[model samples]
Target: MTAREQTEAYEDIPGTWVFDAQRARQGYHLNEFLYSLMKAANRAAFLANEAEYTRRFAMTEAQRTAVLRRDWNKLLELGGVSYALAKLAFTDGKSYQYMASRMTGMTEKEYVEMMLHGGRSPDGWRSRAERQGRA
Candidate 1:
């Protein structure tokens, strides 16, 4: 398939975001700011003043707002790579499981229980077209 066709195919997948070139370019600054949290001093500055520390990056206003709100799913929608976004979770002294639970709109205990029960079923609408009854 052509690259455009491949990209469109990726778009059809429900609840999935491909970190393709377009997303990489769009999230560059946002990811950079997230990764910056790896530094102790940077984390300290961020903890001290989230809005101020966020201003140092060239992130979009929406990205800044999502970061401030700790909106994990919104960050993903905004093109943030999950791995990079994990830095923010860690900076907040939370576990990856906590961030992941938030992403799925579940409490950590619910997420853990779901995982223990063999995880989400793969039988449900796997794509937007399927969900919309077009496929």
Candidate 2:
């Protein structure tokens, strides 16, 4: 029926973001704001008054909340690109592992151990379709 509905058929991969057409459109403003932090001046302004800064970028209230909450999963669900989100993470002086740990619901130490042990167990991880007995 729509481009978004078309993607509903295949975007069921577990524990991942696809950055599909729908997501790209949805996250455009958010990703733009994240990417804008590439400049030190912009980053400074953002850190100064986040709410005002978000407003300046025309970011949705949900996006503002996701940023303020540092809710990485919610940000992704709101169409944020992992690569772009990394800029914000770096601005906060966080490591990629830190972001990954947050996304996976693991403490950094536990996540590091899991990585050392060859990453998370795939058990109990399923797509929406699989969970719904569609796949």
Candidate 3:
């Protein structure tokens, strides 16, 4: 079907034309339905990338699926490098650092410092602390 025909069909459906009433009343058109579709696509892409990253990084099967589903809370529960994996899926290394800072309760400077120092050692924070104390 044509674009206009498709839009008309969409409007004919009950509770589907989110933009129609608002656009009519306001005399300004905003394609809310199209925007929603784009947002969903973007989210799906992000989830797919998260899955790939988890798989490549050797995450647990359950954890990999959780990231693939964009279950952010489940990702946090997985801990270790899961947060870093999420950031990597979303951005480049520098942007990931900024995003990690925003999402993980750390300052941007702190995030950068951690990256510079090689963030999240394999043994994690407890091992790092012990090693530091011994030095």
Candidate 4:
């Protein structure tokens, strides 16, 4: 079986690991967004036309080579999406919420809610909600 198939198969194995199906699905969706953005004509042209994208987000020569070879996990481990989005926002006036929505199939409002609720991090918004007796 392919690597992806093997990974999928592992999901069915009970007690194999701490599996979060929702998080896995979200990661998959985010990867798809990164792939599409990397290949999009408009985005490519925009990157090409905009000097700052290259100046800020383009990987180093070694990183570029690694990314070109589809080393996705490595790229992510090295701060791929986060780095790229931060650079894009800093140089292009885009917001992380907008970028996160674009990358994760979530709406901007949803992204904001998630951020506010600490859904994106370990310390979730539950505490704040609880403080307000909304939890």
Candidate 5:
């Protein structure tokens, strides 16, 4: 398959977002803003004025919205890398587990239990088309 075809195929997977080169470029500014939270002063500034701080980055409006909303799924859909997003979570005084649980639409306790029990079942829909009965 051609590179474009392969990328299209990757998009078929359910609940999965590939951080490919395209995504890396798309998310460059967003990731940079997120990574900036690594510094205490930046974190404080972001916490003090989220919209203002976020505006400093040249991210798409959708990406800006996702970041402010803390919409983990939407952020991922908009190319936000998980590792970089973790910085935002940390800045909020939240744990990676908490952020992950929110991403999976589960409570922290439920997410923890699920992990302890070996994670999601392999029997579920593997692709979007499969779930739609169109595969």
Candidate 6:
């Protein structure tokens, strides 16, 4: 099927990405590298030579760059699943809040405050289709 055919658009729900089957297939190798972190030796080896580990996973250039740059949000945009990505964060001894804060362009305190306020307002956060409709 074509990309457009496989895609199903929905109303904007900020900071959410469904890890469906298509994403699962796309993320398999990346997830595999994250899961490998369950083993201390593998985790250590990866930290020692990130480029080598990335090459072993056969990650795309974009994915590899995201990994090297610690760009969690970009990794997700490139099809990395949240749960799978969590493993990478854990391997680095980082908390979920830290990762989420980074991904959302907020400090940990700001992220907490937003969550306490029931997340970001959706008032002006409509999807592209919605914006076009308004115009």
Q: Compare the candidates by TM-score and give the number of the best one.
A: 1
lDDT of 3 at 104: 49
lDDT scores for all predictions? 0.92, 0.85, 0.44, 0.47, 0.92, 0.78
Supply the global lDDT for candidate 2: 0.85
RMSD of candidates 1 onward, in order = 1.4, 2.9, 21.9, 13.0, 1.6, 3.4
Give the distance in Å from residue 120's predicted Cα in candidate 4 to where it truly belongs: 5.1
Instruction: Name model 1 segments beyond 4 Å from true.
Output: 132-135
Clashes of each: 0, 0, 0, 1, 0, 0
Order of candidate numbers by TM-score, starting with the best: 1, 5, 2, 6, 4, 3
Q: What ranges in model 2 sit over 4 Å off?
A: 1-6, 123-135
Tens digit of lDDT per residue, candidate 3, span 4-120? 776666554331222344333432111121122234554465445644433334445665565455444344444423333444344332455565575546788987898789885
Q: Model 4: which residue pairs collide?
A: 117-125
lDDT of 4 by residue, 40-124 (tens): 5636654565434333443455444434443433444333556443443433456766755655567888888887886664233
Candidate 4 vs candidate 6: the lDDT winner is 6
TM-score of 6: 0.78
Runs off by more than 4 Å, candidate 6: 1-6, 10-14, 121-135
lDDT of 2 by residue, 23-88 (tens): 889999999999999999998998899888888776789988999889999899899999999888
Cα lDDT, model 4, residue 132: 51
Q: Residue 95 of candidate 3: its Cα lDDT?
A: 54
Residue-by-residue lDDT tens digits, candidate 6, 1-135: 555544555214345665667777887888887778788898888889988977888667888889888899888877798777887888788888888999989898999999899997766456654445552
* Clash pairs, model 2 backbone: none
> In model 2, what lDDT does residue 121 have?
61
Model 3 misplaced regions, further than 4 Å:
1-53, 80-89, 92-135
Q: Give the TM-score of candidate 2.
A: 0.84
